[model samples]
Structure formats: C-alpha cells, structure tokens
Target: MNRVLRAALFALVVAYLIAPLLVVAGVSLNERQVLFFPPQGLSLRWYGAAFTDPSWYRPAINSLLVATFAALIAVSIALPLSYVVWRYRVRYAKAVMAMGLAPFALPPVITALGALALWIVLQSYGRPYTVVLSHGAFLTTLPLATLTVGLQNLNPQLVEAARTMGATGSAVFRTIVFPFVRPYLIAGFVFAFVLSLNEYIIAYMTVGFTFETLPVKIFASLRYGYSPVMAAISVLFFAFAVVVFAAVGRLGDLPRLLGADETD
Candidate 1:
C-alpha cells in the first residue's frame, strides 16, 4: 500500500478502537443525569458521583485490590517458572509450559466453570484471597511468556562471564540477569494487572454476583439503565490503562515485549 493509503487505514483502525471510549468519556462529562451522545453540556458531576457513591467505590476498591495482588502473585510465580524453563530445558519443559498456559488458551467460560468447580471441591468460599489465587493461576502465564521472550533475546554469555568472575548463582542472577530482564518483567506485570482488572467471566464465576469488581459493577449497572456514572467509570478505566501502558512503553521496547518485529 502507498504511504497515504497506509496512513489512512491506520487512522481508520485507530478511530474504530477509540470511538467508543471517546463517546463514553464525552458522555461522562455531560450535565444530564442520564448518558447521551453529544452531551447537553460539560460538567464533572458524574465523576464526583462515582467517587462519592459507596456502591461504585466499593467495587473499584475490590478491583484494585484483586489486580494488585494478582500482579504480584503472577510475577512471583512466573519468574522462577520461566527461569527454570529457559535455563534447564527439562524433558517435560514443553508439557509443563503448555499446562501453565492452558487456562489462558481455553475458553474463558470453561476456565471459569472449572475454577468454580475446583473452588467448590476445595471448599474455598467467600474468601477474597482465594479469588486472587485463582486469578493469578491464569495470569502467571502471560508474564512467563513475556519473560521467556526477553530471555531468548538476551546473551547467555553474560551469565557465564559473571560466573567466571566468581559470582554465585544468585549473585549472577541478581547482578547480571535481573537488570537486562527487568523491563520485560515490568511489561509482563502490567499486562497481567490490566488483564485481571478488565476480566469479568472468571471473576464473576468464582466470586459470584455477591462480590463486585469494576467490570462486574458495570455489568450490573446495565440492568438499571444507562447512567452517566457508568460512563465516568469507563473513562477512568480507559485513562488508567492508557497511562500505565504508555509509561511501560516509555521505559522499554514495548513492541518487542509484545512479540512485534522491532524493525517494523
């Protein structure tokens, strides 16, 4: 395609992705109580309402808590697991890796159902920590994959050099390996955090309608008719995600982390 045509196509794709979010943000600023396009007037009433409302605040807090814990847990698990896979290349490496990633590859509903069933069998009910554990189970795979890719691109000779300098295994890892892979680690953590924050089905199935996350709150709000508060929530979520990912991109070659060709 010609440069002009390619540019136009890119712009079109951008518009298609951004349109709904822009509309939601615009409606959030509308002075009217109900959501409407081309808002009657601009105001921050809905934003204020969202913050002030316990109903919204509660769910937002729950989502934040879950996402934070999930990110930490996923990174912790993925780090060692990925290190083993990359360094050892064990006989069952492929099988182990596939099992780790199976949850993400399977249909979400099926995974949720399976998780729910497991939770029931294990008698873990109404436990927020268990919910975090369940979310982390699937989320860890993304970070593992991301870190593995980063490791693949690294020079193994560096680790050997550190060892030759009398560095112990832990010392070499901490001093040499960690710095090079830190960017990928951050990228993976953010990926897991964002995915967990936006995820609904597994969370809904595991926690049920009794507990609410941001997405679940939004879904519930739909039953009571569209409100400007929902739009405000949507805007907040979108802005937060964009700012986070943009920060990550600024710190690292984000396209490479996403498995995109750096030359392109």
Candidate 2:
C-alpha cells in the first residue's frame, strides 16, 4: 500500500476500535444524570460518584478479588500444563490442550450454561469463588498458548548443557527453562488477568442474583438508567487494561507475542 493509503487505513482501524470508548468517556463527564453523546455539560460528578459510592465500590472490589484469584489459578495450572505439553509431547498432548481450551472455543453462552449446570450439581450456588473458578477455566488457555510459543522458541541445548553439568531435572528447569519462559509467563499472566476482569456472561449466569462483579453492576445500572458513573468505570477499566498490555509489551517482544516472525 502507498504511504497515504496505509496511514488512512490504520487511522480508520484505530478509530473503529476506539470510538466507543471515547464516547463512553465523553458521556461520563456530562453533568446530566442520563447518558448522552456530546454530553450537555462537563463535570467530574460521575467520577466522584464512582469513587465514593458504596454501590460501585462493592462490585469493583468483587471484580478485583475474582480477577486476582482467577489469574493466580490460571498461571498455576497453565505452567505445568504448558511444560508437559512442550517437553513430553505425549500422544494425547494436542487432545489434552484442546480440551483445556474447549471452554473458550464454544459459544460463551454454552459455556455459561454448562458451568451453571456443573455448579448446581456440585451444590455451590451463590458463591463468588465459583465465578473465579469459571474465569480461570477459560483464561488458562491464553496463558498456555503463550507459554507454549515461548517454550517452542527455546533451545533444548541449554537444558542438555545443564544436565551434562550434573544438574538435576528440577535444577535445570529452575535455572534455564524458567528464565527463558519468564517473559512469556508475564505476558500470559497479564492476558489472563485482563480476560478475567472483563468477562461478564459466565459471571452473570453462574452467580445468578447472588454476587455481582463490576461488569454485572454496570450492566444492571444500564437497565435502570444510563449514568456517567458507568462511563467512569469504563475509563478506569480501559486504563488498567492498557497499562497491563503495555507492560507486557515492554517486558516481552510484542511482535512475537502476537505470533509475528521475530526472525525477520
């Protein structure tokens, strides 16, 4: 593409992705209680409300708690799983990985229904922890995929050298394997964290009328009336997500993380 054409295309794509967020942020500053594009007047009232109101605070806390626990669980499970798949390459490795990622592949509504049924069978209703578990189930796949790519790029010679130096299996892994994969692990953790934070459908279905997360709270507010507070929350969430991904990009090779050929 020519320089001008390429620049125009890129700008269009950026606007397409950013327009909704910009609108939400703009509406959040409106002095009016109701949501409107091209906000009637500018004020920080909604942002203040989100910060001070218990109604918003509680759900925000819930979201943070769930996202933190889910990210931890996802990383814990994915580390070993990725290692096994990369090192052993067992006969059913692909099948096992696919099954682990099944929740993400199916329609989200189907996953929500399945989780609800499973929760009912397990008799764990009205539990916020169940929502965390469900989020972990889906988010683990992203970390696993990221770690797998990192492992694939790793040179086996490093491990073999450690072994030749009389290093034990665990020692070799700690000294060599772990360091090489650290960047990927960080990337995976951030990915899982963000996914768990923003996820809504599963949280909505599985929690039912019991517990509420940030997204659920925002969604409920929208039903009653649009408020600038929702926009404030959106702005916060967007800022957080951007910071996380930017940190990941800085820590690791962004192009490689996105499946580009780093060799070129």
RMSD each, Å: 1.7, 1.4
Q: Candidate 1: misplaced stretches above 4 Å? A: 260-264
In model 2, pairs of residues that clash are none
Least accurate stretch of 10 residues (summed lDDT) in model 2?
255-264
Worst 10 residues of 1 by lDDT: 122-131
Q: How many steric overlaps does candidate 2 have?
A: 0
User: What is the per-residue lDDT of model 2 for residues 19-96, given as tens digits with 9 covering 90 to 100?
Assistant: 999999989988878688888888999888998999998888888899889988988988988898877758887787
lDDT of model 1 at residue 105? Answer: 85
Residues 1-264 of candidate 1 have per-residue lDDT tens digits of 699999999999999999999899888988988677889888998899889999899999999999989989999988888887877758887677787788878888888888789888988855677668888988988898899988888789988887888999889779877887898898989999999999988888788666788888888888867789999999898899999999988877878998875556
